[model samples]
Target: MSSEIADAKPTDLPKVSSGSAVVIHPRWVRITHWINVIAMFVMITSGWRIYNASPLFAFTFPPAITIGDALDGLPGALLWHFAAMWLLAVNGATYVALGILTGRFRRKLLPIRPMDVIRDLSAALTGKLSHDDLSVYNAVQRLLYAGVIAAGVVAVASGVSIWKPVQFQEVAAVFGGYDAARFVHFFAMATIVGFLLIHITLAILVPKSLRAMILGR
Candidate 1:
């Protein structure tokens, strides 16, 4: 079993056959998903630039990965960051609202029990998880997607606190203080980025998932 598992490759995973393709992703979902991709790119890159201005830690993001200029009071990065923030906020709200209104959330991501997650995770680790059903999300997928949405809310809240410490003193106070809010914002961003990496990796490994997103199959 160990040797068989070691010999397994990503390509060996179960895939959704092209002949069995169906509408797994709706138009609204596809649109929002792509918008999110672009918005997140701008936010993350511009965010890195903003962080370089007065970094919270010892190291800084590399210029190659970062966007905008951080010089002269950080106006460049600030503008980009704010713009992306609004885009992300509006789009994310719409996605969530529509998801709930249309019952997509309940249909696709509901009933994510703890035992299901443990069972699916164990199967995944043992290379027994299947990706043949593109229309349904596994327990792990549901948990991660739901967690990321919650993380986005946290990121936005913490960001608002950091952005307007005086105006949003109440919000900042909820996070302990202005300085503490920055930590929350940083960690939330990190969580989102980590989720994106895993999400993209899985999409690549399961090409049908990417095709479904792009072509709405």
Candidate 2:
């Protein structure tokens, strides 16, 4: 048994090089991703600017420190925020539609089986998992992606709550109240910020993965 184990050929093990180099992310995915990036950036910046209005959850700072004095006065920022919001919304909707229409959603994003999720989770828990270990997404990756998407939706909803508090009184009430909605929005933004840091760290840890996103290899 010892000899057999020692003499086993490396070919018996899964090889990353054997993986296909086909483009995983198509043009639409790339376009939407970059658009979302820009939109998120604008939204965060403008959102911070808007935050300065009443400093919802914290002390109010001057316009010089923040991006804008008020959401309304910062017309450029407001324009950017709203425009980006529309772009992000439309691009996201298009991506979802295309994914469903093309069957890629079922084929790629969805997990293969219950066992796959278990296996991936076990590997991740053991700290033995890598991006190569996943053809699409590991359990943790899928969870995070799902989480970010959900959070995005919530952020959009809460944004509406804040945008038209009078009109969206019911929606605002769902988060407890306007102040509560503001707190939730801020917390959700913080969550995204945390995810971005982790995402960037992982991207750095795996340059090939980052390259894959860029060149769609």
Candidate 3:
């Protein structure tokens, strides 16, 4: 038996461990992710303040979740909003550019067919979605991340439209007009917020993932 084992090919050997550590997120991915998080939070809070200045309807976002009720009021909110907008745009642009140049999207986010989505959704709903590993994003994660990225792009575009309607009149018209553009912007924010809540919940459920992002291993 020992002699036969010695003649066996490497592929015939029983699989061993992949070692104790794996570097999941690179420095750029981790940095961009956190930067986006901070920018997103700042934008949302300040956005609520700006929204209170000209509420969409009888309804208004709760002050508890907004910065409007804090020091500075609407003017301060606008200041924060504008400042974070620049950060979001620049950071997001860098993230996307690097993702492309590094082929990160192609390597990790693609090959996910419609069937993959259904399979992942099924696994997730049935509580079979594995949280034991963080080497690669699951299908649900890939889809959701892609969706959030799209929403982010929409947010930027709609923001630019509302900020300079005359300059981005074409964009406003594409969204059906200024009123429609604002609606679009609001919906984009809602989508982003929804994604964020889900992301946080999952991260809480899977602490390893959070640690991997922070430590890149």
Candidate 2 per-residue C-alpha lDDT over 93-173 given as tens digits, one digit per residue, 9 for 90 to 100: 787687667655555555545677788779867878877733367766766666677687788888778778899899999
> In model 3, which range of ten residues has the least summed lDDT?
8-17
Query: In model 2, which residue pairs have backbone atoms overlapping below 3 Å?
Result: none
RMSD of each: 8.7, 8.5, 7.5
Looking at model 2, report the run of 10 residues with the lowest lDDT sum.
Answer: 8-17
Q: Stretches of candidate 1 above 4 Å error?
A: 1-21, 70-73
Each model's C-alpha lDDT? 0.87, 0.70, 0.83
Q: On a 0 to 100 scale, what is the lDDT of residue 44 in model 1?
A: 83
Between candidates 1 and 2, which one is better according to TM-score? 1
TM match of model 1 to true structure: 0.87
Candidate 2 TM-score to native: 0.72
Worst 10 residues of 1 by lDDT: 7-16
Candidate 2 local lDDT, residue 50? 69
Candidate scoring better on lDDT of 1 and 2: 1
| Tens-digit lDDT track of model 1 for 1-217 | 5754464454332335567656687788899999999998998888888888899999988877877764543688789999888899999999999888766776678879999999999998898999998878999999999999999899999999999999999999999989999999999999999999999999998898999899888
**Which of the two, 1 or 3, has more TM-score?**
1
Considering only N, C-alpha and C atoms within 3 Å, which residue pairs clash in candidate 1?
A: none
